[model samples]
Target chain A: MRDPVTTVRPAAWPKTPALKVGPADDACNVLIVGVGGQGVIMVSKVLALLAQSQGFEVKQSEVHGMAKRGGSVFSHVRFGKRVWSPTIPKGDVDILVALEWAEGLRWLPFLKAGSGIFICDTKRIVPPFACLNRKPGAPMRYSKETPAEVVAHVGEAYAIDATDMAEQLGNERAANVVLLGALSTALDFSSTDWERTVAEFVPKKTIPVNLEAFRRGRGWIEDARTSTPAVDVPAPTPATAAPYRIRLDINPAWCKSCDICVKMCPERCLILNAERIAELAAPDKCTGCRLCEWLCPDFAIRVNLDAPEALAR
Target chain B: MYIETAADFDVTDYLRKEMMPHFLCPGCGHGIALRALLWAIHDLGLDRDKLAVVSGIGCAGRLSAYIDANTFHVTHGRPLAYATGLALARPDLHVVVITGDGDCLAIGGNHLIHACRRNLKLTCLMLNNEVYGMTGGQVSPTTSETRLTTTTPLGNQEPHFDACALATAAGAGFVGREVTHHVPKLKELIKAGLEHPGFAFVEVLSDCTEIFGRKNDMGSSSDMMMRQKSEIRPSAYLDTVDTPFRSNALPTGVLTRNDRPEYGAAYRQAASARAGTSS
Candidate 1:
């Protein structure tokens, strides 16, 4: 594996200036490759929707090959002054966004030689066939490879730990949005444009965290660009400050006792009581992060950081 | 056997004559089901102006386009919701909804259950060809585990939904299932469903000869019709079998019929009662 320190190389930016206007002959072709259920379709949809909102003609096609069963899925998105075809011709893709490292390697042939930008999620899911023990006279064809190795083959690829970043932001599913954020930096789109599209596409409850994930991704790229050469760039750790004391109060009447708050607590600080309502099991472990509050479908649970007892503590 | 000809069975009065030459592929059972529906409407002697047919997007959904009536071709999996509104507003109109397996059981599942629970006065005819024919034969909710589709290359491991059983359990006042091969019986069921006061759900086991049939090795259109004729047993035979579906015996008749209070009539009654109490 290449050094984690060198993974964030400084001179990896595109040589050509990012195109602002969609030229007739030079439509940008983006190929998003990932395993099924990785939200690759949603990412392409958001891209197409955003492009259409900006007065560009967009054509998108998705191939769902055994998508629900952890098989390969990809979408081709072409946008320009006038997009004629839904598919991008082979070897003409401008940007290749792979949600998995192996998928990046698998679809590398689609990228244009020497000029294409490869952005890959550093998450690797071992396919089922790869993990099965080999039988006599029959060998397994699957092998594991690092993101660094994939980046090496692609000549210049950006490897971002999008899943880890999304988990840090309290939802792993927002990794797709995080990749979209990194994509926004490579393209000539503004944050306001992305924000508006995110609001329009993402669910109303998830808008805040998804937008935060997008900004974090954009900021990560910005930091890599401005930093001095050879300086080791560490992953951005969002501020996680826990109050000295906190209390969780669940309104028993409102609580249908779905056990969502009890199950979703990262610290295991909440529990279901005999009445099947949520009860604070360990107040000291409560971080006041409000994950329970956000996850609770019913607005029954409340995190009280400013209780008199908490203040006294 | 009765030899019927086009001249004797002229449904020209109920068809959009100009829209003909229809778009359904040869050997498609959707056409058969459409003919059955048209025959049911003609048999009932229903006024053409008072009937409204709604359909969602699919090969089966295209039935609304060909029928010469007040038809609304809504988005995929949403015909039931639209028909519900039309039925409520104009209770005099007989609103019928046509949908495919994927459109009704997969995407429109919530609306289906709610419509049944409410016992709305609407006839929902779900055509189960066992594949999503319009999208080039993707495996749908009704596609059996023994079958294969583009998405299920290795064979479908997912359990299929029993649409008739689901509708029965969801509180539909009338529930029936029939194969397109049994056109006479299918038409009778549709006619009975149209007369039912509450939610009437009929599942038609249609054939997709081009996509589903070719993939499953179910030979020509005639072969499929023979299979349907031999496979389906009477409703009484279902009780004697352990697993009717596994035994290759599907009951082709009215499965359930109840007399639930229709939603529109109940709503109006409640509203008038409330008004009386306030006065």
Candidate 2:
């Protein structure tokens, strides 16, 4: 299998001819698919709101199966002069926004052949259950197919590293907005309308960062249209990485003893101390993936990239 | 105490008049549960100022909005935890929690068990409609075997939870069960629960007519009520059987009672003893 984290910039963008701005009588069906907590619902809400602003009747139907546990979730959004049903018929979806690579493949049957625009984020979330029966010392099971395979199957597909782009913009949770930015390029909507819809839908505090992420997504697509390949930086390796130790600082006054960060840390580097504030428990094991920092709702924990011990390392 | 006859029970004093008409469906049993709760408070003549109602998110949770008391509509499945804190901090106030089957038995099950074990002075009324009514009738923990729900398009294969048995096992000071069809009996159970000194748990078997009822072909609201009337058995009769709840006969009435030391009073006594103060 190909490297899962490798950025798969679309070789060419705007593959389809410019969409004809048909009258309100012509309806459009958009399908969004992702695992729970990836903000698939938020993207659909923005689309519905933008459709409504354009004086179109919008109907959105969402299937939330065991949400909050990384279960499969999808939404059907139909917008037109008159929306009769909340669900879009099979093989009638015009635009498909998949927040996960495999999920995009899962909904390939729903997309309109030759005409559908498939926008996917090249982030592979390996299903936990997929590894239940694996043998010890076996390779970790992930999506064997590449984004190129997905593009070939869908006929007209754009694969972008939305998660990496959002992380570059300071917050990884803004990946949905990045995909929305890429989606905005395929549609015949103005940037002003997309910005207004995003500002109205996203929280007030996250408006600035999310807007920047959105613009970066649009810019990526615009650059791809000119055959500009996305920057191909080699994946970070522990040896070649910045010779710095991961340092975590916890603001005790800000922490409410939630312990979310401690529980979410994949490296088991954090633990709640006697005072219930998060403290670095196993600093040597710290990989500095920033999962704890991103998952911390209180923003009480800060992971400093460069420590003074870097010179010694 | 002034209410002499059923017809004379004035519920307007207990309700938020501005919030009416309530948003319940035509035959929803939540209204019945709310009425019984109001009647219990009315009969006890408890000061409304000292009464606080806490609820999680569901159709039953909406009971907080309609009641003209200190009501807290908290997040889904955490009402019991919230009520535990309220009961401990302000021992003078009576904290009653209203929750649905999905809220109490599924997401909030851990809190429910812990609260029962703590034996805090709180009344928790669990309205079990066997389906999640607010979210369009998804299969809940209390949904009976072979029942139809939106999620369980086919019949539910899982065995249902016996909430009363669960509470009794969890060490609640008081445990009662009643159906919405028996309003007078339900009111009595609610009143008894309110008067109990420690963690009082009352499970009211209600119906979701629009969702569960319609899906199961259990005709209209009145039809479902008739089914409830026939299915329920007295607590005294239920005790004789080895498997009391193995069949369709649901036991209704106070199943257990004890004099466990309430958490708030016990904590205060322990703290005072540590400080060399007389209790």
Residue runs of model 1 more than 4 Å from their true location after superposition: A1-313, B1-9, B236-248, B277-279
lDDT of 2 by residue, B35-61 (tens): 788889988888999999999999999
Give lDDT tens digits, candidate 1, residues B120-168: 9999999999999999999999998878899999888899999999999
Q: Lowest summed lDDT over 10 consecutive residues: which window, candidate 2 chain A? A: A3-12
List the candidates' TM-scores in order: 0.45, 0.45
Question: For residues A128-216, what per-residue lDDT tens digits would candidate 2 score against the true structure?
Answer: 87655232223445566666656656656678899999999889999999999988876756899999999998889999999999999
Give the distance in Å from residue B86's predicted Cα in candidate 2 to where it truly belongs.
0.4
Candidate 2 collision pairs = none
Instruction: List TM-scores of chain B, every candidate.
Output: 0.93, 0.94
Local accuracy of candidate 1 as per-residue lDDT tens digits, A174-223: 99898888787767567899989987888999999999999987776666
Docking class of 1: incorrect
**What number of backbone clashes does candidate 2 have, counting pairs of residues 3 or more apart or in separate chains?**
0
